[model samples]
Target: MVIVPILLLLLLPFVGAQWLVCGDSGNYTSNSTYQANLMLLSSTLPNKAVSNTSVFATATVGHAPDIIYALTLCHGDITDASDCESCVAAAFKDAQLSCPYNKEVSTYYDYFMLRFSNHNFLLANSTEDQMKWINLRNTLNFTTGGDSITHLLFMLLNSTAQAAANSSRRFTTSRLGVNIVPTVYCFMQCTPDLTPHDCAACLQVVLKHTLKFLDGAQGGRILGTRCSMRYELYHFYEGVPMLAIPVVNGTTPAPTPATRHNSRKRVLWIIAGVAPLLSILLCVICSVVWTRRRRQGKVNLNDQAATNRPEENELVWRLEEKSSEFTLFDFSEILHATHNFSKENLLGQGGFGPVYKGQLPDGMQIAVKRLASHSGQGFTEFKNEVELIAKLQHNNLVKLLGCCIQGEEKLLVYEYLPNKSLDFFIFERNRTAFIDWNKRRVIIEGIAQGLLYLHKHSWLRIIHRDLKASNILLDQDMNPKISDFGLAKIFSSNDTQGSTKRVVGTYGYMSPEYASEGIYSIKSDVFSFGVLLLEILSGKRNSGFYQYGDFLNLLGYSWQLWEGGTWIELLDASIAKEICTSDARRYINIALMCVQESADDRPTMSDVVAMLNSESGILPEPNHPGYFNLRVSKTHEFFVPCSNNDVTITEEPHGR
Candidate 1:
């Protein structure tokens, strides 16, 4: 979520008005079959919901002429079993008082919701369901006239919705802290029965409905049969928020000349008023000036960017203070080193720009990433890469030496890896012999450790949104180091997941939830790593087709071979004879486990490492991988079978 600094409206409306109910109030006669079914549903729901481990239950109380369908859902964050039971119990009681004898009704509480209908609503989309809403009286008015604040708020809400859509519990809350407005706390949820994509679509409709009543309000909530969303000034749910938007405090407004003159006038008036008590006035003025200067001296200049709203140059200055090792390279020096941006010096290309191999005057080799000026999101990318990579240090991760910010040219310098990237060796025929079984195993473990550092051991929780073979650089010793901070996302220590609509990543490598719904977490990265792991083990790329099998993509082909017990055929002919059968099979199994369609089913990096180290542990069976159905490209003019490699780079929204 992008935070735009704006004035916050603090006034709140009546608290009791923060609830809504929407449904038909159909009349039903007392002692009728409909009434009996309704009564049975109400009586059975509370105890059934309480007893279920998930604290959620659905039931049908009759058949044919009269039947009632009901479900109770506890908020994903609600942990106390008793609290969930009480909330559902109260919802039942409230429904009776609120809409007696109504056949279809929905009721919402802070931590739980109880809904029932005469129709089967488990798979129903939100559009068919009318929304109930409550909005705050306080308007979120920004002094400036622009859509930045509104865009930021919606981005946060959409991200929260996406998270909920992909989550196992179908619920999530988020915080969007922008410079322009007070922190907006958002929560979104959907019925767990819906698929990830369907849930996302449902929440999208709910979001659109919310804007109708919530526009400019400090906060609001919308409830529906399939979904619910809320944005408030304060946290309204239990547990930690899943997505915490990175705060970007906008530039502070500079005082105008007229304001300075007014301040002088006020000072003159004060002096005139205190002239009769000159001694006391002089003492008061002295004390005020001394205290103000002392406070200013103690201010943290290291993070001046947050308060002062500095430009790129000021950002460089402040960053220099934070880390002396990350030098600010001179433009002339970079020009001299790279031979004035010669084409021969270019190494590879990325989404933002080109990377060139440069040799400095001191004989130090470096890789310089020259960001493209026309790539509208370049500034943010530059800031993110510089700030994030400079703080992270590990043998399996690329090292940021420094950066150059000269006018239109923004360059990031890193220690150049002589072996190019993993793609150069993995996808080429002649280079196949270079990475033997031992080397591939080492490279796989190294990459896993790098991910572990980012997810668990780093100073900040990091998610490498784009993790693929091309982004993994290789050193002289055949060791792998993960690169590309441009697409990386930083999560608050407490946050576990995030989402976005502008999905930026290499296509075939993306997990199902992330590729289809834009929801990402550490598990998303784990999914990408799984693809990479399989690529390393089998000497096959996941994105392209193979000529030997009917399977369209590498994942499907690998699964086909694995299940058929012809797994040995999946291995590269070069390394097959020398590799251990059990070890190779075990690694393949681990890769499959990592690429499970559901994020919750995937193991963490720590678990991956432990599983790899264990000699003989029973591994769980992996479900079908995401995108397994996409065997071949549909838009081919001529079917060449295996010549084309489809690696797409998208301008996706920033992850939470």
Candidate 2:
């Protein structure tokens, strides 16, 4: 029986009280049959054979522990028994942690969701486009394209399956050229380590779902904890990439900015410089005119603020040292780059109003964030961020390129890192493949070191109250730079912890003590770190995890595996290829230890840094993590087709 995760927010709230309940603790919430089925599937799949594509294994867990376990092999890619166990275990952990308490939760964890249903759930044979069409047609006014479309989709699915089945990574993407020259973009991927045919078969299942229900609309994806397939008539991809499509006759656009600028300069120089220099008489006439302009010198500062170059000394705030290597750009230069804050140039809206990318006159790049006056929640954080970053300097910490505050505008500038953030890579399939073992390990270590500096090594003992993936910026080399210091706190060296009536932080990343009781400290950062480590290793998010296997977060699942001596099973497939098995096991052990249920049991950031940097000795075994014992409810979701966010998903709350 397939387990489907459920979403139910049927909470019994007291006027002013919070209650913790679980089977071991003596209080348990009894759920309905439907709830049970949802929870069962929400629990991770115990085992699914990639060879058994016949059994549908789509699972989503709610806040309750109700996911049922099952095994179904994909058509042809079955491998050793070890691969099956690991995939299921990883999937279960993912669903539980990432889709924490929500009722409806679904993610492509490992390959499948071992789930159960309240009613007889029919498995349908469909393609992604067909299902999209069905959903759109039933929901909107649209025409049906008939069996011809379905047949075409089926053929595309088979091709992707065939390719995936042949590759060890078990993933394939292709554009099928149909009769009208319509390109059907299809993508298929199974657990990375899965053998070829299993990948193909697992993808085939998703393809079937796409054709069966969606009915070929604009776009939709059929995703599972294991393998998945996605197709769209529309191009939904956006990122920095070199397209794989080979062109038979078109000239490739120059990939670098320097090339384009050089080409432009070549044309401009001919019009002004070369043309003027060619004639002496014309040059003398121009010089005389220029002399006349020089005679009009000593113009009073009509607008003292309106310097073409914004003065650097005007906005410097309490600087201990200065680094001239980096350019200190003025606000006006930035305004021009973004066309005076044009809505069209805006990249994304953030807590601090909006962030814009800019190009300086000299071709230097920067990211400008204009703090919004209406952002009440962000005001304090924004001021705090500007103050904190100005005082500290480190490679892993985001470099504060400059700041601007003239009149009403409060703009903070940063060295624009081309790769953006960690979230860009971890939640997508196509992108995760590029973050090799070396790169991920570097990111993990850099974050740890950066956090260590904040907590202990910095001039002031600090706590990054808000730590998440989106805050972790990735440089061009894929190096991670921890950012967003607005929520940071300066704690006295002797203080072990603190409490607040108003607690702030992302839900999944927040430690139980902080989230539920307002208690926080260095240990809280440790808890977040543990989650980050798990996410880096697994490429799954901790928040919105839907698998049902009796864990409230990824920490709990990692602890169970470490306790069971199978923690290496949690590694992301892409990371697994290069992982030294022993090191992988050690890393998980350290991560679990960092997330121990009790604050006292968790290691300091310093200790974590030592453990990561030094492979000297065998680390101590980790006990069960705190805050992982909550019993979650579950819900069921019908057959959905497959899709991938080019980057792999991390199991940590950083992405939340």
Candidate 3:
């Protein structure tokens, strides 16, 4: 019998133990042909990293449709070949287990990184999706000399980036200040294949993201497939810095009086000698360019107009008279405020994209939503928001302070609410205490008033197609403010409802008619409001409410409890102790009424407000809600039914 060594077994757990997995899961099935390719690719990647002299390798397995692209990279600090190989191997195994059937995944181990995807992420265009950022929870703010510390930190980062770009290893470590007590430590790297210019550009991009997101952060990293950056108050990396930044008292030392006088004399002599020659060269070049343009004037006009026409269509928002209430923010200003959309500045991710917390130069806080390029929100939706939301004013609704549009980038700026969203408090077990019964009631009433304004009093008859807890922002005082008008629809005075071939909304919150038949009205909004109401009351997400047992969603579960005379069980325990039984029951009954099977059976927002506010009236009983089954099949095709965690059916539905 073969004997296994005890020492090797003992050391196994210690090898590549510290690591993190990130990136979104791709759509791929398990135990399939593609899955086989992924498994084969993962196995191949570790061996390639071990065998390769550079400790980096990329490989592709299988053909076309089922093809898998895989790559592995070892940090320059990992000098031991065996250790690098072990890290790669561990990353491969962990990535497969952690991400399961995800077709695109990345795992970062202490000594190495392993990434595999069905797409060609090595290309420059695909790098955006492969980017990830990590920020230390701790912050550093020097009370006495803050500017000097900040200035030194950035200088260190910039110098290190330049060194990494020029190095053959495509990696560099840097330190700020002397060995006695360094102000900061930084490490940077890029894939070896990138040219110096490309590597520098990539690092600069991440630096911009860091600037916005890591302003007061003690440590952070912007990790990407092609390039990466990490900095900290103390040395976290394995090796000594390849470069060191000298500490400046303020600026570089000034030249002596004699040296300055000599320098000025030399500068004057050079300028006097070159001025005439420069003037002649400039005139000749300008004359030739003007002659060529005059000759091609007609063709240039036709070509210019053709190209400019499409840009004009995209830039139509610029034509709108800029409102003082909603400034048309410049893209540069937005970048400055949000640190180029740094991940650390991220408040939360919504259906459209990530929202970031930023502060203007004047110290006014703002929340910026940088719309994802691939999101469902298009130019039409952006225009709709700027046109509609800006015109409608309500204290209960979130204020859109401004917007930014430049090239492919689109962003919306709003007044920053410090308490975050309602979901941030209600969904978390510990945080639910921050919002008691009185606060929850206040939130519910505020939402109803916002909806009332949209349906009856606002300038536009708006239907907020997607309404959920996450979309509800809370102020410093915990007052709720309705937000996100991307999916909202406008209704004319004469029209009460609208129909479309495409349906879009959060799964449990979507009205049955809207989800099943692509029809939405003011009543659809009311149905969504009911789902939000139930969520607030129960402190559970309707999307994954299976924890409540047997029930498909919160609506069905609430209905079951109401029927059995055990409805009080649905109240979030945090609030249940103090909530008045009768008042809670009335709110639940009204919520049930809003989610009735037929849209016609649902109350108007105004009526809902009245019912919630009334003290001495017998409310009508609610009927069965639409799609209130105990079981829904997890299986789906085309798009994951629950993937968007919502149904956005593109095909026409057969009406019941």
Clashing pairs in 1: 3-178, 4-179, 4-180, 5-179, 5-180, 6-180, 6-181, 502-652, 502-653, 504-652
| Model 1 alpha-carbon drift over 4 Å, by segment | 1-321, 545-548, 632-656
Which stretches of model 3 miss by more than 4 angstroms? Answer: 1-315, 545-547, 632-656
lDDT by residue (tens digit), candidate 1, 96-200: 667777777666666777887776555353333233333333455445524556656656775677678878878777776767777778888876776787677
Model 3, C-alpha of 577: deviation from truth (Å): 1.4
**RMSD over all Cα atoms, model 2:** 31.6
Quick one: ranking by lDDT, best first? 3, 1, 2
Q: Over the full model, what C-alpha lDDT does candidate 3 score relative to the true structure? A: 0.72
Each model's lDDT: 0.71, 0.57, 0.72
- The number of residue pairs in model 2 that clash at the backbone is 119
Q: Candidate 3's residue-wise lDDT over 528-630, tens digit each?
A: 8998899899988777535354566677788889999999999999989988889989989998999998999999999999998897789999998865665
Question: Per-prediction TM-score, please?
Answer: 0.51, 0.47, 0.51
lDDT for model 2, on a 0 to 1 scale? 0.57
- Write the number of the candidate with greater lDDT, choosing between 2 and 3: 3
